[model samples]
Structures are given as C-alpha cells and as structure tokens.
Target chain A: MYKGARVETIVSISWETLLDGVKKGNVRSLARIITLVENREPGWKDAMKSLYPLGGKAKIVGITGSPGAGKSTLTNAVARDFVARGYTVGIIAVDPSSPFSGGALLGDRLRMRDVVTLPEIFIRSMATRGALGGLCQGARDIARILDAFGKDVVIIETVGVGQDEVEVVKAADLVMVVCVPGQGDGIQALKAGIMEIADLYVVNKADREGADEVVADIGGMLDISDNGGRPQPPVIKTSALANQGITELVDALVQGFESGRNADSWQAQRVKEEILTLVETEILDYLRENWERTGDLDKAVEGILEKQTDPYSVVDSLLPLIREASRSKETT
Target chain B: MNNKKIRVLIAKPGLDGHERGARIIAYGLRDAGFEVIYTGLRQSPEQIVSAALQEDVDVIGLSILSGAHLSLTKKVVDQLKSNDAEDILLVVGGVVPEQDVASLKEMGVAGVFTAGTSVSQVAQFISEQVNA
Candidate 1:
C-alpha cells in the first residue's frame, strides 16, 4: 500500500498483526514479530509501538562472567529450573559482531538442544552492532518486546568483553557473575568488572582442579570489598556439566531478585532509556524526512567531512536551518 | 554447494563468561565459510535475540557453559518465538549433560553439541539445517 514512502506499510500491518498474535501467546507470531523488530525495518517502530504496552511483565535476570567461566551452561541450568517451576522464559544472548564479515556466529543454543524445543520457552540472539556499550540498545528493545509478550522471566546474557558487559549489569534485576578456578588473576580480574555488579557470584566448573582456590579468591576479594552499605554478593560453586549447584544458583537468583533495591533503580533507568530511544527515533525520522528536502544536511555533512568546518559548527549551522523549516511548516 | 556463507550468531547468554569455546567456535565457523558474529563475551538474552534478528541470520547458536543454560536458552527460545523467530534454527553447544539434551530438544532446539564434539560437525549440521 505504501509506494516508495521510505517505510513499508506491510511492515506496519504485519507488525500490528504480530503484536496481536504475541498477546495471544502465539509462538510463531512472536518469532516473526521479533525478526521484524530486530531487523529494524522501516516500520519496526509501528510494531514496537503496538507491542510496547504488552511488555514489562517479565522479570529480567542478567548473568555475566569472565571468558571461560561456564556462564552459558549455568544459564542453561537456571533456565531449566525456571521452566520446571512453570514460568515462561525469554533469553537475550549478546555477542560481538564479526568485524571482518559483518555477520554473527551465535552458538548459545549449541548446548541447549533439549531445552530449546520447549513450547513455553523463547530465545533470541543479538549482536553489539558496534554500540559503544557492550549491551546493545537493540537488545534492550527486544527484551522489552519479549517482556511485552508475557514472558515471566527474561534472562539477558552478555559477552563480558570490555565495558559492554558492565552495561548489561545496569539492565538486570539480578546480576550473576560466573567465574571459574585457575584464571591467572583468579577473581582479581573479576574484582574490577564482574565483582562490582554481582548480586551472586558463581564459581562454575567447580569440578575443575582449582575450583576451591577460585572460591577462596572470590571470598578474599569480597572481604576486601565489604563497603558496609552494600549487601555482599554470595558465591556458589557449580559444575554446569555435572548439574551441580544449579538449584542453589536458582535459589540465589530468586532471593536476589526478591531482595534487590537496585532492581527498582534499573527499572527507572530503563524507562529513561525508552524515552530517549523514542526521541532518537523521532529525531532521526525528522532528519531523514526533512533534511533532504531542505538540502541543508548534505551541505553540512560535506562541510564537516571536507574539513571546511568542525562538527560543532556544522551542528550550529544545521540547527537554524531545521528551525526555520519547522517554523515554515508550522505556518503552512 | 553454492558456497554461500551461512551467517551465524554465536552468543553467550546471561552472565556466563566462559568464552574460549565460543571464541573457538566463532573462529572455526568463520573458517568453515559461515559469517560468524561473535559478541566477545557476556551477553543478555535480549541482546542476543536482537543481534540475530538484525543480522537476519540463518542460525542462532548459544555458548553457555554455565549451569544457567536451561534458563538462558529457554529465554532465548521464548523471546525468539515471541518475535516470530522460532524458525531461526536455535542450537546450543557447551557443557551440556546427556540427560538435559532431550529437554533442550523439547524446547525447540535443533542441535546440541557438547564438549569433544568436532567444530566441523557443528558447521556441517548448521549448513544442512539452513540449507534445508
């Protein structure tokens, strides 16, 4: 129905239909809707608009740890526990995009063959898309979509590479930092990023030789970080392969979610971010629609790229042109 | 074989950070002619789902060596289903036990590759599934 109108009208119709399907707990529809949104097609905003009101019912749990700490196996165990308890779960697994190929190689489901077929469970894989923080905003958006779709628990898994992992810590109601024994720095490396955000610390692969030492290291680090005001994060040992300590880990998750004040803080932060995202969408839409019409944005980009003007000056020049166009449109 | 690269998203869900396997898989898949998106460690289920959707990937592979695999994969599958991405061939590889394999498959997982499994087997399986 839309003819070269910048955005597709089918996307909007399908989006609304998909939202309706999701609200009804239709699995196929849920998957399709997510695909539309994740692709960020022109009409994704419309689908999100329809689905946004349906989200936020889900409890978001974040699990992070250092590389080689068995976080995925731990997450798999926890997810099984949640399902056993009769909760519909959603998972958001984050990975870094391949710089060379611009595509992703997401294998979070590799170990989860048995669980992935559960009719009640939903899973989605996301990429950083070169976002500054490791936790991609696109991931957050899809989480909202899943939440809207009536998932009882939403688990967000991040690749703990650099600041992005820390950013994920900001979004979770309970942040579990998974660690293993025998890393060169032990829990010391975690002390900087993983330790600070943990509601619970998991010493995974506890069957390994240095499991005890890893736990002790974490204990020592926790002792040093006893800031008095913050409740000390608990450390539990588990061999995800052996299915050891998963129940306890789930218990800790429940306890942490039930007790954390920071969850409320995160809720507020998410709300603020949602507002900013909507604003960003509108601004970009406006720029795309009007900038070309006025022929000013191209000039600004050219000026900035050509070194004839700095970014700040380009923005300064572009703002007045936009303002004048808006004023003219308002009068017209 | 047309030699078309299969784009894959290898992600870590929740807070599980054992990424050596994930990294190796990423590298291996890339070498096998699959465009691998390896989000270099510690990712949320939401982030993972979003990435797969954006990239229009044929498969979404999760590497969760953590015991939380049940919860993480369930969440990813649930989210993918919720977004109409149930067809995206969800596969998991890492620290998985034999007993839980059935349950994971029951949850819509197409494949489960545990430790000692050859990366080529994975790449080949993915190739067949995506092609099919």
Candidate 2:
C-alpha cells in the first residue's frame, strides 16, 4: 500500500504473512490470500503449489442453472444446513460482468443474506470476467484455498447459466443442476450439453405448480439416457425459499461428499480437462512472454499490418519456437 | 495483466431502502473497469466488514441515506479496525451533512461523496488512493 513499493514485491513479502495468517486461522488473511490468487498476482502459482498439498480434503460442490433458478438461495440453504450438521462451508457465487466495461455488479450476496453473517460459512462473490463460460478457473483455485483453510465443503454457485456452459464440470467434485418449474416443458431437460453434466438435479421451488412434473421429466430423461456403468443421477425436489425439503438436498450433497472420494464417473475426465486447461494456459503464457520481449510478436504484427506477410505464415514461422523450447525442455 | 484492479465493495449498511445511489455508484465503478462487489440493501456493519474481508476488496464504499451516517460509519470503521483490516481504504457516499464530513474522515474514512458528486470524481479519488 506504500506509494513507491512495487505491488509484486509487496505481494512476495506479504505472501508469507498471508500464509502464516491463514495457518493461524486469521479470516482476514485467508481472504486476502484468496484475492491474491483470484487476481493471479505474480507468484500466485507458487502460492497455490505451496498450498496444494494442504487441499484434497474438502469436498467441492458446483450449482448451476438458468438465471433466476434460485441458485444463491439454495446455496444459502445448503451451506446453512451443512453448518448445522457440524461442517464448515465456503461458497463462491458467480455473477456475470459487463463485457464492455470489464466490471460487474456482484449481487449474489443479496440473495445469500442468511449465511453472510454465519461464522461457519465464508461466502465470496465473483464475476465471470469475460470467461465466455459462466465459471472461471479462478473460482476453482479459490475453492482449493478454502479447502486448504480446512473448510469441509466448498459450494460454487455458477453465474445463472444457459443450456451449454459446462465449465462447472471442470471445477466441482459434485455438480448440482438446479431447475425450477414453469421455465419450459420437459424438452428443456433434454438439451445436450448441460443435461449431461448433472451429478444431481434439484427441482427447486417445489411449492410451485409444476415442480413434480419437472422432477418427473428429468427422471424420465435420466431413464432414457444410457447409463453405461455410471449410477443413475438422482433428482431431488426442494423449495429453497420455503425451506422445505432442504434436509433431503443436504442429504444428497453429503452422500456426494462421500461418493466423490470413490471417483465418480466424471472424475477422470475432469482431471484430464484440468491438465489440458493448465497446459493451454502455460503454453500461451510462455509464448506471449517470450514473444513480447523478443519482439517477434511485434514484428509479426507489423508485417501483418503492412500487408507484407499473412498470419498463416507468421504462425507457421512462430510454431518452431515452441518446438525448440519443448526440445530444450526435454534435453534438460 | 498482473496489475491488480482495485476491487471495491459497495454496501448499504442500514435499513434505508433507498438503493438508487448505491446502484449508480456500482454501475459507475464497473464502467471504470474496477471489480465492484454490490451487496444489496440493509447490510449490517458486521456483515459489511465480513464481506470486505472475504472478498479482500481494495476499498469499501458505504452508501447511506438514512441520516445515520455518523453512527453507521463509526460502527463499520470500528469493526474493520478490530478485524485488523484498517488498511482497506474506506469511503462513504450519500446524504452526508457538510458538518459531519470531517468526523467521518477522522474515523478513517478516506473520502466522502455527498449528494451531487460526480461518479467519475469518486472513481478518480479511489484510483488515486488505491493505485497510487
């Protein structure tokens, strides 16, 4: 915060203080370190690498659905339920940011009023930050930080998503797809991508007229979809606002907490996806860092702008740098 | 890209239902390319402090129209201090009496934007304080 100090140097020095604070159960420090990682400050990966071993204990949950599906309310109910049963909870509630402004009015806390003051629950409001998908990798990293902080469960309420945003699958150990009545007919349940990602389905707002029908429709879809070797996904009915049937939902989540350890059918695929994502990020970072410093990127841009060379040729020439770097990596 | 964008928590810390001012500031801050966390109506100061800590926001902007600015601001300031987060710059925006502004600043609020202050001015002041 000093006027002349470099942010990164401050971060590097404070990272220890942050880590020590987290270890000592300082909530403010835990929160600050989360910001450090979420913003991906320099040395962030090192911080994660240091804390990674302390993770793998807490269960991560992801809740996603169309806008107004009561994701936040249900998250509040579930987190409170978990805490009542003697488990600490962390929640990451995602809301969409304005793509134009790169800013967001994160209003999830408005719906999560009950848990805001709970000592057992740590709620964080996050914006999608132009991730295309409604979820961000940073959300998962924050989940890990919470796990390392010893929370028994971490729930990620994805920005009310559409039918195709499946990024939550990459992050949560258990994915709960929430559905409300009167949104659409059963056909809405059959959409290809999001339908396939549900570990459990909640017919939220069950007090409404069409609740059981929605549950039945999802149940019918589950019956038709080939199970292969996977267990049939369960559909539970709950009214998050009425507080009815919440215990059943919590029961399902707690059962998930146990079965998740056995590597549910999606675990292997999720790991592969995560590693691929990390590889893509790392490779892009390497090229951008190297090219910007070496001026090759600028040279390519200049050639393209001057119409002396095309992007195809530019990429063809630049691809070799990656090969050389990989070869060097292998040799070392 | 590694540079930290100032994250501001715009919270309403009393029972006042007038949320238009907070919404305006939230939109303004967002348009300024800052990550703004908008916790809606009637936030208790404890809740405000908790949200600030867990979100690790760079600054906290409380919007008050309940004529309880002094007491509300003091509670927020005291809670933040007790939580060891006094370093997070605090600001107040709303119908503050001109006479109460000095004491609000004395309570560690970095800036106070009374009615009619431009959003850009508030944003400019925040960036100067946080990104300096």
Candidate 3:
C-alpha cells in the first residue's frame, strides 16, 4: 500500500522520497530531483545539504571547445567508451541561451543519439540560462546530484566559447579542451587563455587534412609556455566521427585523476571557490530583490535616464540602502 | 524571489518526420520570453514525459503532424498522471483536425491548435493557462 502511494505521488514527490530514490539509483527520481535543484524549487537547499555528503565518489570531467569543434560527438564517443568500461556515465551538455528570449535551442541530444539509449548512460542538455560563463547557475549542483545518484563518471560539456569556457575547470577534476583541424590560426588563438586550463588537449577530427599541423601547433605552444613546475598537459588526437582515439583519451583522463587523487590543496581550493560562488549568487539575488522591493532600482534607472545622476553615483547612493536592507533582514 | 521564467518543452512525439511545425513553435515560444527546450524528432511518449519531468517545464506543447495524436497524447497523458505530473499544462499543436479537438481536450490536453493558428495565439494560450 505504501509502495502504491509512493508511485501515485510522482508529480508531488517529497524531498525525502526523492533522496531515497537517488540513493537507490532510480533514473526517474534522479531526473526529477535534478529538476527541483536546477529550478531552485522550495526546499532545494535542504535537498542539496542532504545530498552533498553522498557525493565526492564520482569523477567529474569537463569537456570544452569552440563552437563547431565537434564537442558533442566527442562527448558521445567518450561516453560510449566509459560505458563499455563498466562505468555509469552522466553527461551535462551546455548550450547557449538566446539573449533576446532567454530560451535555448538545445540540440546537443541530436548529436548524442548513439549513446542516449545506453542503460548505464544518462544525458541531459542544459542552457546557459543567462549565466555568463558557459555554464548555468545550478550546473555544479546538478553535477553533484548526479554524483550522489551513483554515477561513476560525470562529464560536463561546455558551450565552448573562449574565456567563459574556463569556468568548467573549477567544476571538474579533469578538463579536456578539444580542437579541430582546418581552422588555420585557431590553435594559436587558443594559446592565450584556454590552453592553460587543459588537463588534456584533444585534436578531434584527426582524419581530416591538417590534423597533424594542429597537433604540432599545440605541442609547440605547450613547449613554449612555462608550466611553473607542473607537467605539461598531454595532447591526444582523435576523429570522434570515425570512433578513433577515444580509448587513449579516456585512459589519459583516468591517469590524470589517479595522479591528482592526493591533491588535498586543490580540493580545498575548489571547495572555497564553490562556497564563494554560492554566496555571491545569493547575496546578489538578495540585493536585487531588496532594491526592487524598495523601488530604489527603478528610481535609480529613472534618474539615470533623466540625466539627474550618473550611473556610478546612483550605485553609490543605493549602496547604503542595500546595506540597511541586509541588516534588517538579518535581525528579523 | 518568485520571478521564475516560464520553461516550456516543445516535443515531437512519435515518428513524425516533418518537424517544421515544432521548430516554428519553439522559436515562437522563445521569442515570447519563455525558456523553451526542444526535443528533436522521433520521441516516444515515455521519452517526452521523461524530458518534461527532468526539465521541470510548466507547459508541454506536443507537435504531431502524423495522424496518431489520440494514442500518442493518451500515452503521454497517462505517463504524466502515473508520475503525478498531471498538473503540467499539456497542449498539442500540428495538423490536428477540427473533429478531434474535443476528444483531445477530453483526454486531458488543455488546448489544441490546428492549421492556420498563429504562433502568438499558441503563446498567448500557454501564458494564460500557466498563469491561471
């Protein structure tokens, strides 16, 4: 009877039930809980608090590259390999949200058709959701949810626009930056910022002409850059479409994880960064709500439009009011 | 804190090879300030319901051009009910016939849009249903 009631309450599932389902490896329950946390539904924070300790068992991998670099196909190939190796893989494919409508055309699954049906694999597409750094606000939390749900490996694929792509480094234990042939100066372009974040560099579509040139370019760039006493990231060549080089890439990823296992300092740093990000998002949200409720935000905008006060000055004046609001909320 | 943007899933269920209607509706919903997630062609009822639940969408607009709306929509509706997700606003759009509109509504689909229906009409209907 209790089991029937539990089955009947799927739509309005409680957090306790969802948590139990997650622990038991129920895909539907895991998907539902991901929605709850992603949407920040009521009691979401409590859910996170309960699930956090259950995480830390899964290996998180971040894959990123420029648009049109075949990131999705590469992810699909890698996922298939992981599944073959007896690992439960969770994939988070991030796509850009339309700036105008704030909606997203998440076509990542189209390229992932091959691995979508695998019983051990779960693939989810995410929109940037106005989060500037190639990832959504709840992506890390979602990854944690997958971790706690018993996935052995969780892979996050970024939207792959430069600079913003670096954000994935903070969330993954190993970050793979993928590049392709025929872009000519593309390898050189990546040298500035993105090259540094790579735990492994993959030259995808290696069967195409100019693949070796891109590989050499990356190798040349890696040699020139100062690693500050750390070993340079390995560069692997792969044609994801042809199902080549994926095993080598996955092996390197596993090796990277093994080497970094005892790196307590990096783990601590990641936790600190996570905490700061959460606090920053929450405080900004609180400040925005307070300003809007007090009508100060609208007033400031009006003043700026009327040319009565400059934007910086408006912010300066509103700071005290925001501070006061924070104080009052704390006391209450 | 309740300024949550509406999320809608525009899914193509069954083996409908033609996706022009679904694509158009996805674009329309996005332009209307809703976060729309488009699940491409050849989705099963189970896949559609799973996507909706995972996405936590407020509204699900099913686009079916293949004349199997009754069975497909019924399967999706039944899955939603079993999952306790019947509260989600279920709307269908495509080459739906005038005669079948009442039956779709009877099967728990909130609204049905047929040929010649403008994108704004569908968007407005969804907004009203969600807000209501």
Candidate 4:
C-alpha cells in the first residue's frame, strides 16, 4: 500500500512481515522493505539485526565513474550478463539530490531500460539525499536488504563522480572505478585518492577516438604506482554501447570476487567499522529525535541563524545529553 | 522522526517522442522537493507497473501525449489493480482531452493535468492526494 509522504499514521509494515517477504523473494515486499529501511523507520535497527544474519552471501559490487563514463549502461550490461549466467541480481543506482530542494531526478534507469523487466533482475533508483560522499548509509542498508533477499549479486552504482569520492570502497567487496576515453590523460584515474580505491579500472567507450591512449596511460600509471607488491588493478576496456568486452570484464569480476572479502583480519576490520558507524548513526538519530521532539533542535538552529551561537557551541551543548544517555546505558 | 521524502515515478507510455513535458515535470518535482524516478520514453504498462513495484513509489505520474490516454491509462490502471497496487496514487499528464478526463477518473486515475496545469499545482495535488 502507498503511504503518503506526510502520512501521520504509523507505517503499517512491520519488520517481521518485511523480513518474511524478503526471505520469500517477493519483489514488492523487497521494494517496500527497502523503502522502510532507506527511510530509517523506527525499529529499523532491530529489523536489520534480524536481516543481517541472512546476508553475507551476495557478492556486492560497487560501480562508480564520471558522469558520462557509462556507469549505468555498463551496470546494465554487467547485470544482464550475471542474470544470463543464472544469478539473481539487484541494483541500487544512486543519483544526486538537489541541494536546494532535497529532490532528485534519478535517471540512471534511463540507461538501464533493457534490464528493467527481467524477473531475475531488480533495479532500485536511489538519491544520494545530500550525502556528501555521493553514497549514503541508506544505500548500504538497501544493499543488505537485497542481500537478504537472496540475490546472488548486488551492484551499487553511484552517481557520476569526480576525484575523491571513495565511499564505495567501504561498501563493496570489490570496487570498479570506471573511466572513459577522452576524459583527459588517464592519470586522473591514478590520482592520489581515487586510484587507491579501485580494485579494477574500466576504460569504457573504448570505441571512441582516444581509447588506446587512455588504456596505455592507465597501464603506465599503474606501473608507476606499484607499491608494496600489491596486485596492480586491472584496466579493462569496454564499449557498453555496443555491448563489447563485457564478458572479459565479467570474467575478471568472477576472478576478483573469488578471492573473497573474508580475510580474517580484514573481515574483523570491516565489522569494527560497521559497528562504529552504526553506533554513531544511532547516537545522532537518538539525539536528533529527542531534541526535535523537545523543540531544542529548532531552537539551536534558530540560535545559530540568529548569531546567538555557532555549530561548535551547539555540539558542546548537545554533549551533556549524550553523556547522560551513556550513563543511563552503562547503568542499564 | 517521521522525516520522509515522497518518491514519484514519472513515466512516458506508448510511442510519444515528446519528452519536453515529462522532463519539465521531472525537474519541477525535484525542485519541489520530491524524489522523482524518471523511466524514459516508450514504457509499456507492464514496464511502468514493474518500475513502480521495484521503486515502491508513492505515486506514478504518466505523461502520455500520444492521444491514446484512455486506452493506455486503462491498461496501466488495470495492471496496477491486478498487481494489488491500487493504493499507489496514479496521475496522468499530457494532452489528455477534457472529455476523456471523467472516464479516466472513473477508471481510478487520481488526477489529470492538461496543457495548462502548473508544476506547483501538480506538486500540491500529489502532496494532498498522497498524504491524505
């Protein structure tokens, strides 16, 4: 059932039902549960706690690239290839929301028209919702929902990006940074931040004029930056427009994913990060809900706007509540 | 928190190649603070329903300009009904003739916007219909 944006009544969907639906691979239930999680509805953490144990099965892949780097098309091609190989796939395609309006035109599906109807494939469009990193925790949660739903693979396609958007690395088991021909000296891929995040590089639009040059540049740059004998990230060429080189890319993905993200220490590190992030989110959400309920949040914002205090002061003012909450938690 | 953003799917059904109107609505809805998922041109009713199901959108806005609003809208309405999605608000925009508007409403379309409807009016209508 469609709930209005401002619906005051309680969201009728219980987490239990959503969990059951997801377990059954019900597409509508999957979508609805994703909405519930993405909205961070109350009791969502408990819901996720139950759903979390059902996941850890799907191989999550993050696809990121510049605006025109064929991220969507490549995602489509790649996801279709996975389906053809008898894998159920889920896609979370993220786009930027308007900073001014908090709304977004999620058009990545436009490029993904071909796979929209495949029963084995499910695509959900997500807006970054002003998350500065071009991806959001909501997206991460949605990925987990897809995972619990028994999708063999889940693709997280971020909005067209530039240098320094490395959040995908934290979310995906393997991150494929896509670059296309004519986007300058391919050294941009090897630039300090983005280069470090890539498990592989895709030189999309290889049919374009500067394809070979871009490939050569990336290969040369990778040669220069070979540090500590770490395996050099592979640079695969794909023309997603003509559906060429996809098999090779998918083959590479199969090989890369086979290594598994379960190296004991690394897995421990991931769990640590996950717990810390969850703690941070829970604390903030608690504080926000409490303050908003008490109207202190509005007062603080008004204070800031009126020059009565600054954000630092507001943070300081909020610290006492956190301390109180911590004390209560320890007592409990 | 009850903080939530309304999600709308703006789709074009049939062979209508005129995208300017749909594009405007997509952008306009965004500026009005709604997450708009645009499934581009020539979407079948089945595809639209599928997209809505996958998106779990609160509203599905169809911009049909091909003079086949009645039949196309009927197919979409039927698809949604059969899929048990009657709660998803369905609105149509385009060159929908005034006379066909009553039949569309009878078929369960929530609202119809002809040539003169402003984006704010559409946005307001959605907010009203969706939240109520």
Candidate 2: give the clashing pairs: none
Off by over 4 Å in 1: A1-13, A132-135, A188-192, A226-228, A277-312, A319-332, B1-132
Count of clashes, each model: 143, 0, 2, 0
- Candidate 4: C-alpha lDDT: 0.84
Task: Write the residue-wise lDDT of candidate 1 on A137-208 in tens digits.
Answer: 566777788898888888988876676787665676777888887887566447455666778888888888
User: What's the lDDT of the predicted structure labeled candidate 1?
Assistant: 0.73
lDDT of 4 by residue, A1-332 (tens): 33342253236656777788788878888888788777767777788889989998988888877778889999999999999899999999988888899999999889998799999999999887764332546677888889998999999998756442466556788889898877667556446477766778899999989988988987887787754555787889999989999999999888878874445355687667666776676667678778978898899999999999999999998889898766766775
C-alpha lDDT of residue A119 in model 2: 91
Predicted structure with the largest lDDT when compared to the true one: 4
Query: Compared to the true structure, candidate 1 yields what TM-score?
Result: 0.66
lDDT of candidate 1 at residue B97, scale 0 to 100: 87
lDDT of 2 at A195: 73
Instruction: Give the 10-residue window scoring lowest on summed lDDT in candidate 1 chain A.
Output: A1-10
Which stretches of model 4 miss by more than 4 angstroms? A1-10, A131-134, A162-164, A189-192, A226-228, A260-264, A290-318, A328-332
lDDT of each: 0.73, 0.83, 0.81, 0.84
Arrange candidates by TM-score, descending.
4, 2, 3, 1
Q: Give TM-score, chain B, model 4.
A: 0.98
Off by over 4 Å in 3: A1-13, A132-137, A188-192, A261-264, A304-308, A321-332, B74-87
User: C-alpha displacement of A255 in model 2, angstroms?
Assistant: 1.6
**TM-score of model 3's chain A:** 0.92
Residue pairs whose backbone atoms clash in candidate 4: none
Measured with C-alpha atoms, the lDDT of residue A125 in candidate 2 is 80
DockQ of each: 0.09, 0.59, 0.31, 0.63
